[model samples]
Target: MTEKNYLTQKFEADRSRLRGVAYRMLGSLPEAEDAVQEAWLRLSRADTSGVDNLSAWLTTVTSRVCLDMLRSKKSRREDALLEGGPEPSVSGEDAIERETILADSVGLALLVVLQSLNPAERIAFVLHDLFDMPFEQIAPIVDRTPDAARQLASRARRRVRGGDVLDTAQTAQKSVVDAFLLASRTGDMAGLMAVLDPSVTVRVDAFAGGGQSRELQGADTVANFYNGLAQTARTALVDGAIGAVVAPLGKLYVVLDIRIENGKVVEITAVGDPDRLASAEVSVV
Candidate 1:
């Protein structure tokens, strides 16, 4: 440990907090890890001699990195509109059990609420309210004036405080999850197709699938994959959202997390490591 570079060691120390910020910004564990890794890469390649507040600098950089990713996602959706195909689902099933260990700790309510906000509002509110970051540093990352950033946070704050957005997102999430599970249990391929987007993606753990491709895309492909799925899996509250769990004899062995957009399932993450699944607190809503 002593032989490690001081910069590297310092980063390791802040890794937990940095990851928390990223996770809240992007609800998906895989995406949050990606953002944190991108931030570390940026720090290693840039000159930081002039940096005084290292923590603040890292926060700003990570926020910018997440902002760019979010904008890229929006751009892809627009391009997809013109191309006449929905955007490809970005799905990965790795380290989710670890990444989401803090999901509830970070306030699942806020995560659901933040999901409804535009990118800028999400960043502004997360940095200012959650992390106590001043709007001055946040403004540049969002490309808005400090006051404007504050106003964005204010608007987001109102919505969050009102709880209307949270209810809506949670309700929508639960409905989709229920529909998917019902279709799977009943082996209704067409029913499964109804709730899945054309570009739907299914990702399962490599260990679970015995070296299979681990990723299946397209509504038809994924729907077929689950047409006669397990009857054991039942609706459960996953990380404070309505998802599903597969277990036998009262021991959780599989967990599914879905990304629903416009009332359709676009991405699905399935984790089946017995240890990780058992570690998850599966509850009924």
Candidate 2:
């Protein structure tokens, strides 16, 4: 077999894993795809005659591409907010899985919450903590001392594990989601209010952007948000689940996740566009 054939075979074998890592790191399917494509272009141009580990080289390239994208996206979000524009909607199946994993994976959540670090730190923490890559290997990838990478990972762990409220908060969040949906579809505002904490927060991720900027604190505010929705939109209980999609007249408007805590509603997070909605199990008419 020719050298080109060997490289092609190796790339085909590792494509899925590369895509998975890129997806997890970037959280957007399209972004991940773009990152991987760029990585492939870099690989095609590299002098592979002496390269011993093609997989590692491809992964390193992919990681750098993803890190660049994340940094660019972060800056864009900051600029958009400054200009009074809405935050960019989370797009693609990869993003959906990232949100679900962040909510569900104990280790993944810890790494995600450490986004305050520089890209190097974030990459080190994810590699060491989540993927179990050795500090020595990670050091080359991030161009840091192995000892420094170890320290970064340790600091990230401490920062994430410091919070003891994760367990209770997650449980309360799930309950809140279930109850709020139930009450909204049944027109049981009282029931909805019952699950909500008095100091609840309600925010809508609207498409026209900047729909509701202020935090809707208190049960009354939460109840009123739903009341306005009910008045302007029609809602139907998504069969087989405790969630609803609110459509304006006949158009799909928002997909809502209701959170209940201690049998009381505590939070309502609304995604106004189907494209932006992370939770997929919605019954759309």
Candidate with maximal TM-score = 2
Best by lDDT: 1
Local error of candidate 2 at residue 215 (angstroms) = 9.3
Q: Which stretches of candidate 2 lie over 4 Å from their true place?
A: 68-115, 160-194, 197-263, 266-285
TM-score of each prediction: 0.51, 0.53
lDDT (tens digit, per residue) of candidate 1 on 48-125: 889997778888888888887776763112221212211223354436456445664655445555665789998998
Candidate 2 TM-score over all chains jointly: 0.53
Q: List the residue pairs that clash in candidate 1.
A: none
lDDT of 2 by residue, 21-117 (tens): 7665664445656677667666666798787888888888888877787777741122212222112344677566554453233322232343335
The lDDT for every candidate, in the order shown, is: 0.73, 0.58
